[model samples]
Target: MIFRTPPRAAILAIAFLLGAGFFATGAAPPSASAGARLALGGVALAFSVVALRCARMRIVASDACLKLYGPLFNQAIRWADIRTNVAAESGVDARTFGVRTPVIVLTSDRKVKAQPVSSYSFSGGTDTPADRIAGQLEALRQSS
Candidate 1:
């Protein structure tokens, strides 16, 4: 099964707002500060495109392995390498949004390596539940 990231409309909305601010006043030639604002707006717009693309990241699970696709990182774990899969909350409140979301932690035999799967939603907020994905991963590990 393939699980994809949720739609990030806020990112795109911010980008649009920033872009609109650049031309809201008038179409006159841009001054130095105006040019800077334009550049910043362009950067935000570009970032939105990248974010939208990355938001399509997929977690692919097959009989042999599970793959996690992210914007900057990708991880693949074979069924044999997986020690256990559990759903847990993230520590440290990484997003600064005051919401500490749940994540699926994948433990391997290696002591130093633990993969956290944050793509799955467990709060009955998203269509796919973390328990279902964890269950599938556990089954795969057991069968292997």
Candidate 2:
């Protein structure tokens, strides 16, 4: 199984950032130099690259191991190493937005960590998809 960043999240963020840049550059006063407008466009391009990097994040699960792919790195965790999987609220956005994203948590003897590459936000309710995925992964762990 493979889990990916939601397409809607990526598209909306990228479009809004790029649109703002285009509007700012296009509406710059006639007195503004070409360099100023180009700078705004460059900033927009940089933001777009970050958004694209985030959107490409994913996790792949196989019988032997689970593979996580992020913007800058890839990691594999063997099934034998993961003691269990559970659904948990992530505090990453909770403090400011009051929205705690649900993610799959993997616990081992050495560490308890959340799956960093993939999170489910709009799939039904806040916790439904995360719970389902965690349950499935736990089942996989038990069988293997």
Candidate 3:
């Protein structure tokens, strides 16, 4: 089964607005320097890509393994390799915006990986709650 986070409209909107702003300002004669325009365009493009990747973040579970997909990272853990799955609030303030966000922590033999699965509110596009995902992970570990 595959579970995915919800589409974050705010992030998408911000990306779009940033791109539009760059284009709008780039059109002005005083700000039309090629180097500056290119720099702004590159930043906007990066933001758009980041937002798109974040919106598409998901977790895929199969009989043999679990896969975590994120904007900046990806990991796969075999069922046998999992020591435990824990659900807790992440301390990262940037992602939380002052509110605590739920995170799924996967403990394996070699390392611990933390993945943010839900936002503080419904706006975060968490299709499945972190605790529920932890439950599913636990079940998968048991079955394997």
Per-residue lDDT of candidate 2, residues 1-144 (tens digit): 886546534664576566656655665677878888787777766666656655666668898898876554678888877877755454444334322232434464554333343353543344544455566667777898
RMSD of each: 6.1, 4.7, 4.6
lDDT-wise, the better of 1 and 3 is: 3
Return the top candidate by TM-score: 3
Model 2 misses residue 8 by how many Å? Answer: 7.2
lDDT of 3 by residue, 1-144 (tens): 886545343454466666656654554467477787777677767666766666667778888788777777788867776776655444444564422233334453454543435444434433335556666666767777
Off by over 4 Å in 2: 5-46, 92-108, 115-126
> In each prediction, how many residue pairs overlap at the backbone (N, C-alpha, C within less than 3 A)?
0, 0, 1
Error of model 3, residue 40, in angstroms? 1.5
Model 1 residue runs over 4 Å out of place are 5-29, 33-42, 90-128
Query: What's model 3's TM-score?
Result: 0.67
The best candidate by lDDT is 2
The alpha-carbon root-mean-square deviation between model 3 and the true structure, to one decimal in Å, is 4.6
Cα lDDT, all candidates: 0.50, 0.59, 0.59
TM-score between model 1 and native = 0.53
lDDT of 1 at 81: 64
